[model samples]
Target: MQPLDKSVYGPFQLYYDHALEMWCKDPANAGKQMSLHSVPQMVSYAFQKAFTPAKILPGFKSTGIYPMDRNIFPDHKFMPTYSADRPAPIPNRDEPASDSDSERRHTATTSPAPSKLDTFTSLKEIRPFPKAPARTEGPKKRKAVMSAILTSTPEKLSSQTVTISAAGPSKPKKLHYDADDDEGSQQCSGKTFGWNK
Candidate 1:
């Protein structure tokens, strides 16, 4: 949907301005001569000119979803006024949430406006869509070569097994197996994202 004009949207104009400030600062936009410090109406102007729904929604040549995940207002940036059912913050790979995580929630009732600019940044509460389902799969992978070993054995039959694991970063694409005479030479290779990627 087309965003409403800055004058019509009330205080939320501050929120869009914060987004524009970020968009114009991206290095990819260098030399574009855009600035967050532009005229008051510029954010809505840019929103009309730039945030086409087609660019985010799926369609031909579409960039797919442009997620505006609710940001917790720790500083002077604009943020969505999320509901009490707000989704949990995704923990960073190496950073588990601390005990104070719950203490830091900046509810509209408790939100602070430390500067005059903060007044322009306040946004009305918005209902967000339900969060997507969580992924259930883990990262470990296993390959079995027992059948090949059984068939390629030389002379009298002998028990042989080959196990290859690619749990983390895989390099060199091809892994060679030096099978003994009974097992015969075997090669197995592939790339795995491990569970982390």
Candidate 2:
């Protein structure tokens, strides 16, 4: 059944909106702009015209509300409640129970509790993992080895002590090439290779 307001049934409203939109796009009303009052009337008329009693009558009959048939519900629905015509068979408390049922009931009552392994052990009771071994000084890198090699050979290097400035390494001078002067280039190229050459 349709709700009082379309917005109250959020999921149904989506399908309803789509159906309304398709109905509005008919060739008869190609470029029509619907007024607020006309829109609701159009929706109601469309729903009434589309969903006739023939389509809806089957739903009421299937639910068994119109004919008032109690048999439509499964056996489970009548399990809790009993009819007065047939009184429920009372168990004979005086008679001795069968061996199988007695054994089953005895085992059910005396079932073993959960094993110690299955039960939860607290973190506080469990022993903590052994502490990680202490970290020692690692071997020197390649740069350190190269520096040590250069400094160790005192005889190879000049005795003159080099002074390091706080300004860091000096920038190299840029060479200006003059195409007109071939002689200057030859001199410069010779010096680059070695003064002896």
Candidate 3:
């Protein structure tokens, strides 16, 4: 066939070459795919194909399988089982009485010694130890002494008096003239010249 185009089929060519190489060297992988259980057989086939007595790398040899020892698989060892059946310990139930009970008993026994009447009698009997005598005379005695002094003085009269006299009667004087004088002339003169004229 004509040469394939390098620009279009370059990556496909490389993949096909690698698959052919794997198929040729691995006898256990008789075809393109193999199962997980056949990995040891495949590794054995690859070692024999890729390595020889003359072509072996330094410090390397064909051991016929991967990891060379069976202990490398963790599932090869044994594991112990666990249980959740054991129960927790329980607390104790019995205990003794406390000191508060004794204190309450003592208080209840000593609460009734003093009554109300006993307290009142004790207060009334608490007077002063010694007493003093009483006096008899006071302000009334002084008042009696003053009254006796005022009544003992004597009574005296005054010498001055006011007198009134009765009024006397007024008397008329008797007039006497010369017995020989002319009475008619005196009358006529008095009547005519003095009174009538």
Top-lDDT structure, candidate number: 2
Candidate 2 achieves a global lDDT of 0.58
Tens-place lDDT digits, model 3, residues 1-197 = 11223222343445445555676677865655655665555555545544443433221222213224444336423433346445546776577546896788789898866755744455447875566678756655443332223333331111111111223343665544333243332333224322222
Model 1 CA lDDT for position 36: 47
**Location of the lowest summed lDDT over 10 successive residues in candidate 3:** 155-164
What lDDT score goes with residue 115 in model 3?
58
- Report every candidate's CA lDDT: 0.49, 0.58, 0.44
lDDT by residue for model 1 over 26-64, one digit each (tens)? 899777876546554666665664445543243222211
Question: Candidate 1 or 2, higher TM-score?
Answer: 2
- Give candidate 1 regions above 4 Å deviation: 1-8, 35-197
Clash list (residue pairs), candidate 3: none
Candidate 2 lDDT over 32-138, as tens digits, reads 77667667765665565545565455555655656666577687766645444576688779878999989999998899777679778787569766788999979
- Judge candidate 3 at residue 42 and give its lDDT: 50
Candidate 2 segments exceeding 4 Å error: 1-19, 23-34, 75-197
* Predicted model with the maximum TM-score: 2
Worst 10 residues of 1 by lDDT: 56-65
Clashing residue pair totals per candidate (backbone < 3 A)? 0, 0, 0
Query: In lDDT terms, how accurate is model 1?
Result: 0.49
